[model samples]
Target: MPLLDPALWSGKASIGTWTPPTGGTAPVVEPATGDVLDVIGVATAEDVQVAAGRAARAQPAWARLPYTERAAVLRRAGDLFTEHAEEIRQWLIREAGSIPGKASFETVTAAQECYEAAALVSRPLGEVLPSAEPRLSLARRVPAGVVGVIAPFNVPLVLGIRSVAPALALGNAVLLKPDLRTAVSGGVAVMRVFEEAGLPEDVLHLLPGGAATGAALVSAPQVRVISFTGSTAAGRKVGAAAAEHLKRAHLELGGNSALIVLPDADLERAASTAAWGSFFHQGQVCMTTGRHLVHASIADEYVERLAHKAAQLPVGNPDKEEVALGPVIDAGQRDKIHALVTASVDGGARLAAGGTYRDLFYRPTVLTGVTDASPAYAEEVFGPVAPVRTFTDLDEAVALASATPYGLSLGILTADVMRGLELAERIPTGLVHINDQTVNDEAVAPFGGVAGSGTGARFGGAANIEAFTETRWITARSAQAPYPF
Candidate 1:
């Protein structure tokens, strides 16, 4: 079955179906071949207001619904992801510029998140505290009423659903604003899954739109919490707007994450890890290894291995061929990635492997002899480009990794795992993996960035609680206590 029915935008709907979006239309294009996949509704600022209104009305009832029933619905949602994994995978590949494996990963992530969110309903929601007076005192978590979720195009299914499912499960309504470019996989598909799983009417609204729509959602008086995942620049605006409105904004922003290779690390294994970290999903990831810090002893061999791996990996239309990487999202994104690489080369960073493109298919690139000033090395080059920079010693490695303002994910490869752990602590990062590469996540792990990255611990496990709910203190007594008159 098509995960998102085009009829959803028909300006009309039968009972128990999606409310027609209040926006214009845009064509969904496959980046690989420039094929118009489908025409989808584009939400406006007014559309966001409408969605927020509906969500506000629906939220109280959803919050009051029996927790078991809510959990059941979420479990069913999880099942749907698994049952329709193939169709979802196809949409992800075609619509989101994901390769088959990456598509599968997103589908699995969606399912896993649902299962984890369902479990949230069964967790203890309140705690008893000491009563100073003749009364019982308790602190309880209550849903933040209507949640506003603005998700990005890259890894849309997971990034959107991670917050969406948990907020709903925690007893809140959601107005989701996904980037119009990847609306089908990011917004409509996830909404469709919830609908099939029997989510209550008006509890979730999916609106695909541009920045103005997001601004509306952020400023809406009814939305109590905003979950935004995108660039650092946009995240700052979201955070500022949310603060002005006195609501919570959970932002997971950009990163130029690093992978450190120690001298003792096996060159072959470390290079393989580095290649996957940088090139996976065309390196359009928040935790993409933008800087490669390798000990000078093995730097030359590591560069050769990394470049060879990048060259050998097949890059093409994922749906048509078994390719390791797919096309970049569009010409603009492709050009931007290429510009960074070219600028780095111009600034004296040697191009070790790729610095070319065919249509939107930018080759996986590697750079050697890069300095901190290299644009591609310093910036979050969200493409299939890996820039290798050499560090002379442990102190130098620490300096190189700490050079950026971002503290998202950090990876260190070393034969001495304990030493790697010590090094990880010295460098500030929200997530770190010793003997591994930077890009990694699981549904159960707390995932967020810090410093220039974003608000820390905004999703997964206990972080979800903080993101989706508010703590309210309650006091009760068998008889009403009188205050002094």
Candidate 2:
């Protein structure tokens, strides 16, 4: 099937276009070559209200349908995703600055999520309750009415569809506010997929814009839940606003994850994992291993091998087939990554490998001698920069891993799998990987973080459906009895 037109994404509902405020249009640029791909109109606060109202009106009929019907639609959507994976991959590369591998991975993951979400439709919503008396009590899960989804720019297709597929499968109407930059490909493509797959026209709405649009979507009273994935700082505002409105808010936020290499780890395996974890997608992933904590016995050799591997990956336009690490999403992000590297080096951290950039394309960088006092150790660079540190003992290693406020994900590389599992339990992250890289996600896995990283709402399988629904307790009397008020 042919993809939808980009021009169709202008502050629209399923059927008609909403009038945008006098907000000026913004140009969507290809990060690698600094080329303007398209100019998109901004969605105003009014647009959010209109979309949310439409979703609220449409949700009841959708929720009333038998789950099998919903499952059928979702299955077809998944098939559509498989059919157009290559086309979708191209969009991710051009608009999201994703390298070929990363783009392909996202497209496949999205297709998987659609199929995985189909199973959620038939999963038991509530269990039979034990009755205490003649009265029968029961509980069942129902749609939250309208779920407002605000997705980030990085990994937009996977992250955006992650929420939308589940919300729709559970019969909640979705109002998706994709990042302004990826409005056409991420937002419109999703809308078209479901519409073409026989979904109800008003059940899913897409409105694309920047911060004002997102805020409006969050604050709308008609929206029963807000599923947001982005920076921790922005997530706080969304969570707080949802709380104030007494709405259910599910947030999958930032991660300053750590990758730990024990003394017994295979040097070659650890080095390759570290390079892939830190430099993939230029390290913009929430689960990217931001810090590398290695044992003192293997720190020097591991860092050297990691640095050597980082130097070999090609950094260029994602449009090219050979490029492994492309540019950061924009110049501002590039500057921020460069600033963190500069500050870390000036503060006495040793630069072991690449530490420079040409335009938005930053070379994969490796640093050693970084201490807790260094900004690179404390903040999330969200770039292709890895800061390595050595620890003398397991307790110290655990401490270093748990030092960050963000507890999204962690990785441990060790030949001793039992020891790694024991350490994984001690870490305060939501997800842990043994003998693998930190960046891992599947449609069936429960994916989210705790503490500063997120609101403890996982975004796959049953967890996703739960996030977009509410529970109602119903009671009935088998026989009429004298009741006092």
RMSD of 2: 1.7
* Best by the lDDT measure: 1
lDDT of 2 by residue, 227-287 (tens): 9999999999999898898988899999889999999999988899999899989999998
Model 1: CA > 4 A from native: 9-20
Clashes of 1: 0
Estimate, for each residue in 1-485, the C-alpha lDDT of model 1 and write its tens digit.
Answer: 46565766433211124555566678888999999987877777777777788789888999999999999999999999999889888889998889999999999999999999999988998899997799999999999999999999989899899999999999999988878778888877788899899999889988787888899989999999999999999999999999999999999999999999999999999878999999999999999988999999899999999999888989999999999999999999999999999998999989889899999999999999788888998889899999998889999999989989899999999999999999988999999999889999998999998999998988998789888999999999989899899
Index of the highest-TM-score prediction: 1
What is the alpha-carbon lDDT of model 2 when measured against the actual structure?
0.86
Clashing pairs in 1: none
Error of 2 at 49 (Å): 0.6
Backbone clashes for every candidate come to 0, 0
The lDDT per prediction is 0.89, 0.86
Question: TM-score of each candidate?
Answer: 0.97, 0.97
